[model samples]
Target: MFDAQYSENVSHPLRVVPLSQLARAGGLGLGAERSYMAPVLFWIAHGQGRLSVGGALRGYTGHNAIFLPANLSHGIEISPRCQGTAVFFAEKSMLPFPPTELHLRMQGVQVQSEMNQLIEELRLESLSDSPDRDLMLFHRAALMLLWLNRQSGKPHVPSVQVSDMLRAIAQPKR
Candidate 1:
């Protein structure tokens, strides 16, 4: 069942998925887990839920941000009232950056506030029919991810020759 109110957009190299405005059902249970070819940054707001990633289970409440590395199997058990935004970035987006070991770590500073603001802005931009909204939201998403990566002490893995090779092998032609 598709809701007319919820709109989804795929902006070239990235996918911006807003999970709000969907009708709330009963508690969501675990099912077949899947992984992504590109890194996925998810922000959960206004929900009490549990997520299982790479065999580890973590609980989240209120507002929380999580990063799932590419090709890592993960599943979410969303509460009936769950609402959030999920942003997917192609490997190209991480290019010219350092590796996750040196760039993707999270800082102790609470960045949820800023992240929430970005999510709201993205939601608005996604819903709007303006031509520039997609471009604006795309840049905002990149900035948010960079901020989070910088704070976490993770090195920005640049997509150099070697990095590109790795990405290529990680994503073979379909």
Candidate 2:
């Protein structure tokens, strides 16, 4: 049911929707309902806006990237001048990496390049209307997820809460 391995080794299961198309038609975000589907990647090539991540509102501008975990309630409020792409990955599409949330500046060379290239490919493929677009999108999306994970630095291990510890000691379970 899960394939964390490279996408090339698994059946294609990804959908890449171009934000430019949606932007041209009408703005997205603000009204976008909070989702609980899968991890989503948002790349801003231009403009700026505010993003709501798990109830935490964050602001972003051009060249910014946001990686949101599936369980988080996420949405965006694109500015009138905002422009970019949003990737909605199906659950388990880019596996192996423990679920994580991030807001990258993309100022680093590697992060910027990988993101731009991936978005460019998405834009092109989105316009091509190819029969194998699903497979192609999957391969790129997986790679992008892996790239973001690598650039996001070391994994974060959550610290146990003191309250939980006290509760555990107060009420021992057999």
Candidate 3:
């Protein structure tokens, strides 16, 4: 099921929300078919569900990461017990996200923990009011892109390395 609603605000470069919140919102904002002007990433840490992307239906379970590119129709049916986070990225950002969709079944505890940490960092950066909050968010978001690209086996140009260098330089010396 998909919703025809298309009024999502893209002013925020990124957003992270629990899957339960979306499920509670109904219209299958958790299940209904919907499309956004920006890309979306779904990280399923627990439970199982059905997802439809670009008109193809597939089943997804825990430790899964799904990426849907902008303007493509998608909808998900996550179980009540599903524990997950949805990451939305503004279409206007300069981040180097892959042009195609990805449904990654992440394996290994190390890789899973790495993805979780990166998301936690993004969530924290988003709540800060620091003068360089935007820059920090961009850097963190770029790291996420780098992680995704690497995990997906896609060739990447390493822009996040520059962000890492900038962060090192910004840190106060011990």
Candidate 4:
């Protein structure tokens, strides 16, 4: 159920979906097995659950963020009161974060606010029907990755890329 094929028909590769929305739409629920070609980030706003990644099962509580790398076997089962957001992007989308299971280290309130802001921006761009929404979402997600790295205290320094588009996304605006 986490296959990237589920979203292949869409215009862009980046997708930000609210967890509750997915639940209400019957897209996801308990006891579902899913593995994605793309990486996924789970921003748990509230509630607790157990998630298994690559045969390693871990439990998480409220206000936590988790990352599952591409093709990693991962899924979660939470109580009925869970609420959060999920971000899906291309397989190589999450640069700087590495291909590991990460429980993000949110150092302070300000860092948490920054993550929330990034998620909100992602939600907005995902909902917009503008022609440039794809490009916008890509850059926004890149920023989210960068911010996540910063929160982990091991930010990556991006190098030049194939095109200005990629370079722009890798480098924060000055």
Candidate 5:
């Protein structure tokens, strides 16, 4: 059986969706309920599953990562035991970097050991109610992305620039 919940927040050009509270009812499938209008970064841990995105099945196991472009239909099916974090933001969140470029860079890049560590750190940060948790996690997420991009042979961009873009994306629109 499949069961899921959906929640989202919109702040004009920036939107944040917290999908961490999701729990599979039958413990069979793991991952997001559905794709969103904006791009998404999924930091999944302690789960063995396969993600169906754009009509393709991308398999993932312990400490796996996946990126979904905006409006791309995707789903996750777990092996009865799964848990993780899903962070979604708009394509406009990272200005200057074309969405197509970012998507191309992230596609087919498997999560590595270091990336898994970063995901774990971000997961712990998310569990805390501390005010700085969000900021810190955002930084870590950007770093993870940067690392992935580098591994994929994508051109290097300044980390500071990425951080700034992430901050802008996280901010509530006026």
Candidate 6:
């Protein structure tokens, strides 16, 4: 059986994995309607696919990000050309991530670039051995969630400069 409080208190807390890896093991049973204990976000870097969430089927193309809340049954059918990253967030994570499902089709080149950069940073953080790796991961994940919120028409907030964010995360957590 799975850990009872795993979603609430995962050791590592967050993960960033390539979509291919997610699709490798029978798509992690994603093809069949299922729910995760924690929330998951998928950033589609390329290609097209259809996602079924809460019994609603929707088609998505490249430059898209999909966020699904925990315990919300869903399934995905990604095309062979689809490319993306799957971001999993711990249930008890304090980040201000979207509380509902979001399917954002990023339109502008700048927006797409920002999303790409954010995902890359998350990927690097996930692979790093920094003493504050988990902390850094949470920080980057928060920025990404912010980006998604912005694209989804949430209230506008001052954007954090990359240099400032990097410097902040570099500081050792006390």
Question: What's the candidate order when arranged by decreasing TM-score?
Answer: 3, 6, 4, 2, 1, 5
Off by more than 4 A, model 2: 1-13, 20-33, 92-98, 108-110, 123-135, 155-174
In what order do the candidates fall by lDDT, top score first? 3, 6, 4, 2, 1, 5
lDDT of each: 0.59, 0.67, 0.81, 0.73, 0.54, 0.79
In model 6, which runs have C-alpha deviations exceeding 4 angstroms? 1-12, 27-31, 156-174
Per-residue alpha-carbon lDDT of candidate 1 for residues 19-111, written as tens digits (9 for 90 to 100): 453224322244646566666766776676777776777676666677776656766676657777676665445332223312122223466
Better-scoring candidate (lDDT), 5 or 6 = 6
Worst 10 residues of 1 by lDDT: 1-10
Question: Which pairs clash in the backbone of model 4?
Answer: none
Where is model 4 poorest over a 10-residue stretch in terms of lDDT?
90-99
Candidate 3 lDDT: 0.81
For 10-61, candidate 4 gives per-residue lDDT tens digits of 3336778777766665634335657777778889887888877666677888
lDDT of candidate 5 over 19-106, digit per residue (tens): 3344444332434546566666665566666767656666776555566666566676755456555655434454322233232222
| TM-score to native of every candidate shown | 0.60, 0.65, 0.83, 0.76, 0.54, 0.80
User: Which candidate number has the best TM-score?
Assistant: 3
Residue pairs clashing, model 6: none
Candidate 4 Cα lDDT to native? 0.73
**For residues 1-174, could you state the per-residue lDDT of candidate 2 as single tens digits?**
112333434443344555566566563476663654566677888888888776777799888878777656666776657777777676755353436787878786766777898778865775567898767766666567667766677443334674577678999688
For candidate 2, give the lDDT of residue 108. Answer: 69
Q: Is candidate 3 or candidate 6 better by lDDT?
A: 3
RMSD after Cα superposition, model 1: 9.7
Superposition TM-score, candidate 3 onto the true structure: 0.83
Best by lDDT: 3
**Per-residue accuracy of model 6 over 1-174 as CA lDDT, tens digit each:** 112334534434677778887677554434677777778888998988788888887898999899988778888876656798888887677777786899998989999999999999998988999899988888898888887887799833444675588779999989
Worst 10 residues of 2 by lDDT: 1-10
Superposed Cα deviation of residue 112, candidate 2 (Å): 1.9
